[model samples]
Structure formats: structure tokens, C-alpha cells
Target: MITFYDILGIALAMSIDAFCVCICVGMKYNKPANYMRLGAAFGFFQFIMPVAGAYAGRLLMKYTGNIKYLAAAFLFYVAFHMFREAWKNKECKVYLSDPTVGVALLMLSLATSMDALGAGISLALWDGGIIWASCVIGIVCALMSFLGVFIGKRSRGYVGHYAEYFGAFILAVIGVRFVL
Candidate 1:
């Protein structure tokens, strides 16, 4: 059984990408209403993706016969990708004068929540409660994203990238924990 702390940790780890991207969104738009919109979009996707992934994972597990290692592998891949993106793009700039909405916002939400899909697969392998876990993930991500915008507005871009690195490290650690 997955403890609350474990679920919390996973939710936080999954929220990092959304938080970082929301920081960029906040920096770009710098409007309070935009923060809410972006947060909702991110939270919604973050919620839905895991449920979909968990269902898919259930199907895959039947064929694969035990997917804990596969889950760890996916986490590792996500971690490595996070590191690579952080290193490759030392700084990100968004030049739109207006807040992101519509298709662009949807794209952004989907991009950031991709890791949660992998996490959902792992959650299934571990026999965790998908509904509760996803709810927590969504709520936490929404709050983080809302805050990230404010933080980004006040600070420069350096912090957001480093946050991504930290997130990657957290995910790698979680993946290692699963393996052990």
C-alpha cells in the first residue's frame, strides 16, 4: 500500500515541470488572471493524464508480466530528459505580450504533464490508488503553478531552470527507490 507521504512525494515530483513552465507563463504574462487560467489548465491535464496512463498501464502489465522495472525505466528516461532539456536550454524566453490561452495553453499543459503519464503507469504497477493519487497530484500542481507565476514575476529566469534540475534529481531518486 502506498502511504500518503509517498503519494505526496510523487505528486510534488510530477508538479515540478508544470511549476517551471508556469513560472515561464507567469513571467511572460504577469497577470493574476492568467495565473489562474494556466494553473487550471495544467491541473486538469495533470489529473487526466495519469488516469489514462494508469488504465493503459493495467493493459500493458497484463501482457508484460510485472512492470515495476519498466516503470523505473520510464522514470529514468523522464529524469534524463529533464536534465538534458535544462542543460540544453539554460534560459527560456516567451515574447508574447498576452497570456497563453486556447491551443497554446493546451499544448503547454500537455507538454508539462507528460511525465505524470509515466508516473501513472508506475502507480499502477505498485497497485496504488489512481483516483486519490491523481487528485492530490492535480491539486498540488495547481497550487504550485499558481505560486510559480508569482515567483517568476518577481525573479529572473535562473531559478526556474534550476528547479527543473532539482525536479529531475527528485524523480531519479524516486526511480531508484522503486528499483530497490
Candidate 2:
């Protein structure tokens, strides 16, 4: 069974991408509505993707043995992706006056929530309460994106950049927990 802290950690880990991307959006578009829309879009994606992945994971779970190992692999991949991005340390810029609409929004949301889907696969294999887990993840992501925008506008992307590493660390630890 997964603990509350585990869900929270996953949520935080899953959110860092959206948070980092929104920081870039915030740097350019300084509107409150943009922040909400970005957060909502990302949060909605983050909410739904994991649910979808968990159901998909359910199908895969039946054929698998020691599913925790598979779960850890997924989580570890997500963690590695984040860590790799952090190491690259490149500032991703959204060249738009309002990035909360149209293709940009959809692509960004999907990109960030990919990790959540992977996490859902891992969690679903172990726990039956994925809806709750996904919900917490969405809420935390929305809140983080909201704050990330504000921080970005104020700090010029300095503070927001390092968060990915911390989030990656959390995910890596959780992934380790799954196997051991």
C-alpha cells in the first residue's frame, strides 16, 4: 500500500515540469489569467493522464510478476528524465504573448503530465486508490504552477530552475522504495 507521503512526493515530482515551464510563461506574460489558465490546463492534464495510465497499467499488471520492479522502472525513468533535463539546465522559453491557449498549451500540458502517467502506472500496480493519488497530484501541480508563475515573474527564472533537481531526487527515492 502507498502512503500519503508517497502520493504527495509523486505529485510534487510530477508537477515540477509544469512548474518549470510555467515559469517561462510567467517571465513573458505577466497576466494573472494566464497563470490560472496554464495551471488549470496543466493540472487537468496531470489529473487525467495518470487515471488513463493507471487503467492501462491495470491491463499490463495481470501479465507481470513482481510488478514493483516494473513500477520502479517507470518511476526511475521519470526521475532520470527530470535529472537529465536539470543537468542540461537550459532555459526553455515560450515565445508567445499568451501561451495559455491553442497548441502551445496543449503541448506543454501533455509534455509535463507524461511523468504523471508513468507514475500512475507504477502506483496502480501497487495501490487501488489512484483516483485520490491523481487528485492530490493535480491539486499540488495547479498550486505549484500558480506559485511558479508568480515566482518567475519576480525572480527571472532563477529560483524555479533548481526545483526540478529536488523533484527528481524525490522521485528517485520513491522509485528505490518500490524495489526495496
Candidate 3:
């Protein structure tokens, strides 16, 4: 029987990606509202994905094993973009940096939540309810990502021009983790 502690631990573990990605976003922008928005996006994905995985785990896996690779590819692409932006002499572009908005937001949310999806597959076997666990995970992810953004924003000046580079490195590491 899974306990609340177990769920909390899982939530913390799963939120790392969102937190890291949010730190990246925070580096470029100091807006707290945007940080929450990014966190919400991640939280929403984290919430839905695990439920999807719990219900549709085996069914979906049969159709494709490339989900991990696809996620990794997206992360790597995003990371590469970040690295490029960091290297450029001009001001960083808005589209990629402001991941609180469109496709970039969705992709990052999906990529980061992949692990939560995997965790959900195991949740099917546990006596603990899926909804409650997913809720906790979502809330934790939102909070952590928000905190990451704040921290990143605070550290921006200290990091100087390399903030994007660090963020990109974090994303790349996350990508590599998804693959292996």
C-alpha cells in the first residue's frame, strides 16, 4: 500500500525536470506571472500524462517505443537553440526564451512530464489512488518550477551571459537522461 509519503517522494522526484526547465526560462525573464504560467503548463501536463499512462500504458506502448526518443529529440533541439542564443552577440530571442507561451511551452512540458507518465504505469499496480497522487505531483511540480524560476532570476546577474548556457546544459542533461 502506497502512503502519502510515497506519493510526495514521487512528486518531488518527477518535478525536477520542470524545475530545471523553469530555471532556464527564469534566467531570461524576471516576471513572476510568467513563471507561474510556465509552472502551470508543466503541472497540467504532469497531471494529465500520468492519468493517461495509468489508463493507457500498455495500449500506447504497443503502438510505439519511440516516445522516449522523441522526447529526447525535443529536449536536445531546445537545448541547442538555447546554446545558440547564448553564443550570439545580440539580445536573446523571445520565442524560445519565453517558453511560457506556445509550442515551446507544450514541448517542454511534454518532455519533462515523460517520466511522470512512466511512473503512472506503476501506479496502476498500487492500492493508492491515481488522482490524488497525480494531484500531489502536479502541485509539487508547479511550486518547484516556480521556485526554480525565482532562483534563476535572482542569480541572473551573477551568471552574466552564461545563464542560457547553463539552462541549455540542464536541458541537455535531461534529454540524455530520457534516452538512458
Candidate 4:
């Protein structure tokens, strides 16, 4: 049986990616409405993708194992991208009024949260349902993303870059850990 602590751990770990991505999107976008939509999209996908992974794991193991590698690769890739973006010398104004940004945000959110999907596979293998886990992860990610966006919008200075770098480093370490 999954305890509340388990849920909290899973939620916090899963939400780290969302938190980092949300901050970047918030910095890149302007409309508050867009942030709301982005948050909802991230939360929804984070919730659903894990459940899907869990079900898929029940059907087979080879695919599930591949998912772990895929997720690790994605995390490292995104981490490096964030690092590069943050390190860039040019500063450009955000054109957030465009809805196309939402697609990009969605893709970023999905990429960063892929590890949680594989974790869900482990849960399914253990015969543990993801309902509780998903609820915790979804809610935590929504809130963390909201906070991250709000902070990014307000700070827009040294702190945001630091956070991005830190997230990227963490993702790199996690990816290496997964590979080894």
C-alpha cells in the first residue's frame, strides 16, 4: 500500500521538472491567462501520462525498460537546452501574445516529466494503482508551477537564471544516474 509520504515523495520529485519549465514559460510569456492555461495543461498531462505508462507496463516489460532510457535522455537534453538558453548573451522581449507558445510549453512540460511516467511503470509492476500518486503529483505540480511562474514573472533577474542552471544541473545528474 502506498502511504501519504510515498505520494508526497513522488509528487515532489515529479513536480521538479514542471517547476523548472513553468518558470521558463512564465518568464517567456506575458498574459496571466496564458499562464493559467499552461498550468492546467501541464498538470493534466503530468497526471495522465503516468497513468498511461502504468497501464502500458502491465502489458509488457521491454517497452517499459525502453521508456526509462528515453526519459533519461529527454531530461538531459532539456537540461542542456535550459542551460544554453540561460547562458545566452542576447536578451529578447517575449512575444507571449501568440498562442503558438502554448504548444512549445506543452512539449517542454511533457519532455521534463517523462521520468514520472517510468516511475509509474514501476508502481504498476508492484501492483500499486496510481490514482493517489497521480492526484498528489498533479496537485503539487499545479501549485509549484503556479508559484514558479509567479516568481519568474516578478524576479526576471539573477535568481531565475540561477534556478534554471540549478535545475539543469540536477537533471543532468539524474540522467547520468539513470544511465549508470
Q: Identify the leading candidate in terms of TM-score.
A: 2
For each candidate, what is the lDDT? 0.83, 0.85, 0.69, 0.63
Task: Report the lDDT tens digits of candidate 1 across residue range 54-119.
Answer: 888899999988888888898898889888888887775765755467788888899999999998
Model 2 regions lying over 4 Å from their true place: 92-94
Clashing residue pairs in candidate 3 (N, C-alpha, C atoms within 3 angstroms): none
Task: Tell me which of candidates 2 and 4 scores higher on TM-score.
Answer: 2
Question: Which candidate number would show the highest lDDT if scored against the true structure?
Answer: 2
- Could you tell me the TM-score of candidate 2? 0.95
- In candidate 4, which residue pairs clash? none
Per-residue CA lDDT of model 4 for 36-119, tens digit only, reads 776777777778877886776666655444455555565577567767865762342344454325477667667756866765
Off by over 4 Å in 3: 57-96, 157-180
Rank the models by lDDT, top first: 2, 1, 3, 4
What 10-residue stretch in candidate 4 is worst by lDDT?
A: 91-100
Q: Rank the candidates by TM-score, best first.
A: 2, 1, 3, 4
TM-score of every prediction relative to native = 0.94, 0.95, 0.65, 0.63
Query: In model 1, where do residues sit more than 4 Å from their true spots?
Result: 97-99
Residue 136 error, candidate 4, Å: 1.8
